[model samples]
Target chain A: MMSDKEPLFSAKNRKLLTNPLGSDNPITIQVLGICSALAVTAKLEPAIVMSISVMAVLALANVIVSLLRNTIPSRIRIIVQLVIVAALVILVDQILKAFAYDVSKQLSVFVGLIITNCIIMGRLEAFALGNKPWPAFLDGIGNAAGYGIILVIVAFFRELLGSGTLYGFKVIPQAFYDMGYQNNGLMILPPMALITVGIIIWVQRSRNKSLIES
Target chain B: MNTQSNTYTFLYAAIMVVIVAAVLSFTSLTLKDRQNMNKEIEKKQNILKAVNVTSTPANAVELFDKYIVEAIIVNSEGEVKSNDKAETFKVDLKHENKKDLSKRKLPVFVFNDTKVGKKLIIPVRGKGMWGPIWGFISMESDRKTIYGATFDHKGETPGLGAEISKPEFQKPFTGKQIFDESGVFTSLKLVKGTASNNPHAFDAVSGGTVTSKGLEAMLQDNLSSYEKFLKSSK
Candidate 1:
């Protein structure tokens, strides 16, 4: 619907960029990417790294898909999308392997799993297929950010309570241990991550009634 | 755009495949060196860990070179084979373990420890529940008692089997004897539940019996090759 005379960032495109952050959050609202959310959030560093990797892949994949949208055959669109996403994921995985070896090891196969992350494919199919490159790029970044925000938040609480640390730094004072404060060991487990995500969804839905389904 | 034509579809897929292959291979080829260097550093760190010496990735290479005085590739016959040709660091267990025991090049790293003096570190690998479980066992100069040991797994379940890398799991191996009182090579066993006050058998990780047993089997399998060498040395 954007015209040549309109402002570069119109209200419509701004909504596309901002809606995913809160009201249309991917992890909290759309409930996509819950697998990686529960898997890597035991520690904040890995979770943060995973989020960035996913963001890079998602953003780049969306742009590539959108740019090729015109040429992509109707019969082969899904395969085209998979090929693009896989290539981008491999590139990200290789770069991470070269630059951040430890974090790469911590993230492990999850970086490759970004190819299968429904959020990336969802955005490309729902938004990128129909939108222009710029709008698609913004949508990609917005949705990825929404997913990354939830990952970081979940990791924050998990790392804080499970290991009494944040990003590997001991945040809870040792004196607290002397006062019988025990880090919840259960929080380090996968179930606790699901519970944390559930709590976020609950709180979010409670505040925003529109997100609740009949 | 004749999108549904078979000719166009085949051409498109072929072109796409070629493009993806070229870009992926190019990326992998360029980053291979740095990735390998990181792996080497990690291996050095783990080897150092077996001797109670620790170093970060930044300083692992320097520390490794300073402490590890010799890298010998010994065969099953207890003979130290071609020193320069073998290139001990290049010995990969995943490959060597597949070869016949007699043909395998068993690399041993001699660590010059400050307190324990000279220590021999032998690397071993075996199958865990999920994937490969590997470790370094630091043997005292006598080659009988374990100075220290370190275990690492490829894809073991966290908090359960992955605890093999924890200090508590590795510490109990420090004073355990690899040989019995009569000089019988017993290696070590990861017994379930209570350890029965035996020096050769250690209690396995409670929830990680498979990985613990895998480590025990790896130690036995790899260490058996050193039996002739250990006996000859004495």
Candidate 2:
């Protein structure tokens, strides 16, 4: 369905998917959005929820911006994007408060902070403004998923080591605590999320030599 | 030519404004009912918590209906003045720039629990790590011993200050005295050390020092306003 205007799922489009995964990845390559990456990764549940929320906002914003790309005055394009992003964020915030009040409460300012996430803005400016809606949407989702992958991994380790649980479920037996298994309290802190992401980048780069260059 | 240019700019700006406004209005109208329902459910959930009636979101409304018998709004002096429970609960401490001494109406929800009998749940709002923090503080029929508490914050750091909302942190407040035997307002406290052996003191959240302090300050500030009402009720 995408090839009529240019080439259906062309090599360019294929690069869009793979790029965010490694070479041109927003988190690993550009090192954007490290703030939320660290804050929400202390547990898998919040991390996953945050990732989905970001993805929803990113994908929707990309499509909306792409549709309006033609008429968006150059001088006001950034303002327009901000307005759209803010609207979406507010809508999402209201929905969360209404539906998932607890999680929404837990998320708090981070939901409002979605407007500041560079990845969403980056995709709007770098990819969405120039591409068709489908490609822009795909790029947004792909990058969001990449970000989610990093977050889930970090949260997995953090929750396991910090709280000795998975998604708040106790995993390590009481025997481990009885045997003197000390929960790494540091893993629950924000800085640990950063270190976890950094380590993942290092491992990912080592495994795939090409990603190292980026 | 000048007229043409003026006309075009006017039309363009007008169209843009209308389009944006319409889009926002449509979105708002589309989601308004669901959003309102969600907020109502949330309030019900908080009210339920104050009375120790724990339930998930799906059942909050049902549980609230089954347990909550009365909701009344009391002014700072604790006089029953309004029938609107929700509006009284909407007091925004952040928006109201008045000093802490300013009098305001506080929403008090009366829940009749099968196990715990009648309890008064008061809504309290105050400052926290990032912005406003608020919660429901339920008092037993004596209106002294705290029954259960639930707190939420705007932007406090998760796993740290944000833990204030977690059950592990708030559960400590349960059974703590909000007033002394003389009926003097002792104010249930979030203390530094392990909540002194006093019934009025509650343990501070371990990692969330600032948030814990915030919770303490919030309780003191809001509950003090309702002292007159509390005293009159006694």
Q: Using TM-score as the measure, which candidate wins? A: 1
Q: What value does DockQ give for candidate 1?
A: 0.68
- Candidate 2 at residue A138, lDDT? 82
Clashing pairs in 1: none
| Model 1: per-residue Cα lDDT over A61-144, one tens digit each | 888888988877778888989999999988887898899888777766577778888998889888888878888888988898
Docking class of 1: medium
Each prediction's TM-score against the native? Answer: 0.92, 0.84
- Model 1 chain A is weakest, by summed lDDT over 10 consecutive residues, at A1-10
How well is each residue in B97-199 modelled by candidate 1, as lDDT tens digits?
9999899998989988577699989998999988998999999988899899999887787668888888988888888898999999999887875565777
> What RMSD value applies to candidate 1?
2.6
Q: How well is candidate 2 docked (DockQ)?
A: 0.38
B168-194, model 2: which lDDT tens digit per residue? 777778788877888898787676776
Highest DockQ: give the candidate number: 1
Error of 2 at B185 (Å): 2.2
TM-score of 2: 0.84
